[model samples]
Target: MKPFSKLREECGVFGAALRSGEAAGLTYNALLALQHRGQEGAGIAVAREGAVFCRKEVGLVSEVFDGRALESLGRAGLAIGHVRYSTTGQNICENTQPMVIEYLRGRIATAHNGNIVNALELKRKLTEHGCVFVGTGDTEVIATLIAYEALRAAAPSPDPGTAPADPAPSALSAPAAPDSAVEAAVVRAAKQLVGAFSLVVLTPDKVIALRDGTGFRPLCLGRSAEGYAVASESCALDSAGFTFVRDIRPGEMVVITPEGVTSRQVLPAARQGFCVFEYVYFARTDSVLDGQSVYQARYEMGRMLAAEHPANAEVVCGVPDSGLEAAAGYAAESGLPLVSGFVKNRYIGRSFIFPSQAQREAAVRLKLNPLSFNVAGKRVVLVDDSIVRGTTSRKIIASIRAAGAKEVHMRISSPPFRHACHFGTDIDDEKALIANNMTIEEVARHIGADSLGYISPAGLKTACVHGSLPLCMGCFTGEYPLFVGRHTKTQLETR
Candidate 1:
């Protein structure tokens, strides 16, 4: 079992098309801003002189792409990068992305965020047609799919020495236009995908960006004097010194080249299923997703949580990182003093893979230590994003009690996590979910909290009302925006 009881999103993706300067360095900075999304692996692929060069490894962004590695990629006008925490494949170097594939047309590098639900089906078909895979992750499947479509579009007719099929004519794909065939291929490949995905494809001449029909993941456009940038969140754009442009609309595909940018409606708009957890936990607080401020959303969640489950405590304290903003809102709404209850060690990464239970329990303190001065002899209301399996919560509440807190009343900012997330957020097993087996009171007792309260689903939705799209509350409500069936990470990675 893992030590930390938290959900994990799959990956963060970034792409840049610059008129001057090396894109690899700018992409590195963007990945750093997005490091919160994933830490298991990092990669960057640069398109240079009709060739693609990529460096990827199973480690954090800074660890994987040191100065030497970044320098080795050389200066390039187009680049795409990824930071990954595996939801579909094992955490190995082979699965680390910005998957660079050499295709019939040329070389293209692709970075992806979000889960592809029908990956297995697609992979089987591709395999039957003699496509061999070197990586187990779905991203390779997606990249190959695009390459296959592009090859199909450019293939000659079956008849004797006939000319190749005309590339489907559209505003973006004018007949006989070789440059736009890749864009058409992207559209065709996107139509076959069944779940959440935001893709950035780096070709020698241009970068292409696409989002799912339902917009289950976030993707946005950015602009600089040099050129355009694409990222999973607006915070990365800010980190890379780019101005936030409008979000790439649901089902929209934007092609960025040195000449400028053009867009095509790759997939028709489905029911807007923007992942609500982006605001609840997955995103950086600084990010703006689909026009909603993640910080403001969390603040409102805190306010709503206080209204719905006001704690009888002398001080309000949030779990470090994600909980701090909500805790501030809780304190403001409840008229309680907001206090720092824990000092987090910034160096420790997620403690989810300790070898033993004893070591796992001990690792909790290595990451966060209670500030005994603030909590001692005070009734403390502890706010957190959510409790996954209750292990970390138990450890945290125990530490607060040991610190001489009079009481530790736990308040959760989001609704209970009950179902498995099949859209990129990692949940080990639905059966392992604490809420699946325990009642609210039982969970509170299990976590050793004096009292516990969870914000209602309605409250969570209201908290994120600034969002332009409808929310996907699948994990909380067990009713996904699209068909998920009984898919699991284990199943996806098994073969």
Candidate 2:
């Protein structure tokens, strides 16, 4: 089988509950709002009285969960949900998220939002200890590790037959001995795990939210009339009618229960390396990440790209959704006409599901049909967020040429991806990256574009003015913030 082309984003996790009742409906709503983050699969898990009920499938949230499944998942005061886009693992039903594990003590259902760099090593060690895995996914590996560590913490007294103290119905009280014990167990487990992760776990007693020490991914807290919610992106909270409270601090764990929300610091705050792509392409335009609006960031990128690479063209067009904002900025700066050259099919859910390569190519055409009238005999400048493998750019150029464009100049908003990213953005294997092997001019000629240019790394830094903290240009510059070995097929498959 051919290696799959990697995209730039990963998954989204949402967990919420109303102290009054299970948040099945609200979680469903939140997942719907976060569906933009992942379209391949979705799942929801609800915990009630030490037992967990879950429903998941390989499809969009609407396709997977209906009235029947929602009712079946039923009401537990605690529920966690996930939408997944496969990064390292195969896209299968078993890999769909919110993995639930039933242990000797209680049940834990977890949904994770980022990739673990040392997942394969951890999996190997766990398997040697007779840990059986049902799914070939990194999220499952995390769930197993957390469970293993929790069990280890509970050892020396195998059967501590004490029930966790129940909180008062109306007042917030100190966490019971069991709650504190489990919290310590999870903290110890998290310390052992490395790489990028923003996780939400539904335990029998509370919902725990945790972010990695470096804050590689974004996670925020929100509040609804029913209760508090935690999600990967703030836009989901907005769509679900929740007020944005604040972002979950890096390395912080906040446990929400009937007694109210309590936070504990598992690790001290450090310089955050949130994925810059979140602002460029991944997040919804309306979403604000790290005190900046995604739309504004892209707009600034476009303006900066225009200043760096001033192109003379009759019309400027972006490659569908992600590129649209930058294209608008380019047109505004270059004094060129901005036209909708391509019309995207909003109904297309997942781009990877097309039956064959030919079908996938055709799907691209069907997904974004070009406006012949807008490009005929005109010089067109195409703007896109980034070029991953050059396949998409080649096909897009073909579309523009087929539409009778005389000249096609390609402009990229972000610098070329020359290194693999271990912090959530799904860039895998430097050998597969076109920029790593070929220069910009070579890639332009290979893709049949007249000219191609990328925004300089300096411009990327200048786009953010308020802070002098350095951004992770690892994918562009091959300088990683964390040490990550070159990823191999063996490692990805086994993990």
List model 1 lDDT by residue over 142-249, tens digit each: 987777676444444343112233333222122222446667777778878888899998877889999988998999999999999999999999999999998999
Per-residue lDDT of candidate 2, residues 1-495 (tens digit):
134343556799988866756577778888988887888899999877667778889999999999989989766778889998877577788788888776544567888988888888878877776677877778888887666655434544443322222223221112222455556556765776667889998877678899987777888888867788888888988876779998887889988775568887776556567677777788888887767777877888888888999876899999888899999988888889999889888876565476687877766687788899999999999999888888888888998899999999999989998877777666766788899779889999988899998998888766654322346677888776667776432355554
- lDDT against the true structure, each candidate: 0.86, 0.78
| Candidate with maximal lDDT | 1
lDDT of 2 at 114: 84
Q: What is the TM-score of each candidate against the true structure?
A: 0.94, 0.90
Clashing pairs in 1: none
- Model 1 TM-score (2 dp): 0.94
